[model samples]
Target: MRATIKDIAKRVGVSSSLVSLYLNNRPLAARIAESTKRKIDAAVKELNYAPSATARALRKGKSKTLGLVVADLCSDYSSFFAQTLLDECSRYGYQLLIGITHYDPEEEKRVLANLIARQTDGIFYALRLFPADFLKSLNLQNYPILQLSSAAPEFQSMELAREEALKQCAGKLYEYGCRKVVVAHESWANILEKELEAYGIKIVGGRYATTSDDFPYLNDTPPDAVASDSSIYARLLRARCRELGIPMPYLCYSYSLPSDFIDDPRVIAVTVSDYKTRLSGIVSRMIRMLENPKEPVAHLKEPVRLMSLDELREYRCAQLKDPYYEPFRIRIKYEGN
Candidate 1:
């Protein structure tokens, strides 16, 4: 059986209250007598006693766990974000719980409520669709909410400057001699279609945000290149083209990590909106809010750049020592490395 604080108290001939005061309560540690603290410590070591995390969290009203509610994890870009966020959470000794909604409103609501019930310290919301006073609507007003969007009255947010990103997509595709593009997401496709029309590139077709197996557009003559907000869509398109014995077009998608797809010759480029910086930046704000409940609402915006295959290859070869991307040694060309 696992030893508990009561066992330690019994071993030391002291009250479990005093043992808990020294073990879980930090501010009150000073209140414990030096002799009592030493007795508790020795008893803990001798009995191998451990405090229950759930009990302590309930007492303190903090689980030290943050929730990331995202649309889908199948996408490479979203997966990277989750991985980076997990790393960030671990740095501060906090746990991360991800809830995948798959763009379903009912599923989104259920997952959110479940996260809150688990006593998540805060929630980092990445969905574009917002319901005003959503927390209040669910009777979860006291919970803190953060968003990947612009300034909002109720919650803190970190926005992405997507106008320039969309423009870069069209301009790069146009430069690549692409005249028509099929996008992955619907709402985003609507905005991107308008932007592409500005560059004389037409958006031929689009699909739902989460998942769509039927991409008849690729089965046909195929557009110049398939542009996607998520790399998963590009991957799906590639699979469909292969199954139908059709050639895949020059593909463009969003993914900052270049090393993951450098070998794909058909890929035209990937957009990098400084994903690493945005995640770490927002994580900092999340930490502040978790530590200080009264922290004011904060808002921010970031940029995006479309990096062509050549630029990505250059970035890979140079491989500078970066805090975000760890630098490593590569072999000389003579060894067939």
Candidate 2:
């Protein structure tokens, strides 16, 4: 059995109340001599007794724990988001429980059910797609849930504005002379990728994008273009580029590329915002709303913030570019256009 203050007091032949005061670093009355405090400390060290959080939380009637759920753990962005949520929750003296559902709706439902069963104080779920009846059921339960990166059927969520962000990225790529770029992405993600295509992007791997037997990458034949569904498939396409010796430069739409892969000069990776930074922002806003707990959820619908690739690149270029000009004297031109 784990030792408690009672056990420590029994071992030290002192009152449990005195032991508690000594253990909590509170000043005991002058009647309790310093020598007696040393005995209690020695007993505690010998027994390796630790305070119980379960007891404390039960007494306080607050669990002080937060649950975080993510759709796919394999994605860099999802993994980073999980870590960030934990860090953000820590600032509020909250413990975090994490759940991974691997992008399956049934699995996601199961994971959420498990977290709820564990009695987490709140939940933050990142989903690929929201399920039907998700919001209605939650509204019935009156649960505190935050959604990220997935659309909930009737449940409102904050997610990266993928379409808007990618459109800006694609436009920047077009400006940078990447006309024949291919955006290899999941089939369901094609809708999001199409936002860029609508802005005159001729991506090679989008829907209606073709494959050819005449291509050097295909040793034998070609097949009709089908949407990709996994990062492995995306890597296969990159490998095909290697096999064909196609020197086309590309930027990944998602934070699926590993750090090692991003180091490749041919690839320009877009860094998603730090999960902890974004979550901290969200939690701060939520805390502010809690000050006026009576406010409707509609009043709390401040847009979730996301960083754009164009903004990231521009920041990076500004940092890399020299601000001071060399001492070169140029003659002034008098002609006005």
Top-scoring candidate (TM-score): 1
Report how far residue 83 has shifted in candidate 2, in Å: 3.3
62: Cα error in model 1, Å: 3.5
Model 1 misplaced stretches (Cα beyond 4 Å): 11-14, 18-42, 52-61, 71-80, 100-105, 128-134, 140-142, 149-153, 175-177, 206-212, 259-269, 291-296, 318-337
- The clash numbers for all candidates, in the given order, read 0, 0
| TM-scores of all candidate predictions against the true structure | 0.76, 0.59
For residues 1-337, write the lDDT of model 1, one tens digit per residue.
Answer: 9998888888888888877778876687798889988888898888877777767776788888899999898754577689889989999888899999988898988888899888888889887535666667766554578878435666777776666767777777888899978777764575677778888887775533346577777555788887776655677778788898878888877755533443467887777666567778888888887778786666666777767777766765544345455422222233332
Least accurate stretch of 10 residues (summed lDDT) in model 1?
327-336
Give residue 57's lDDT in candidate 2 (0 to 100): 79
lDDT of 1: 0.74
Q: Each model's RMSD to truth, in Å?
A: 4.7, 10.6
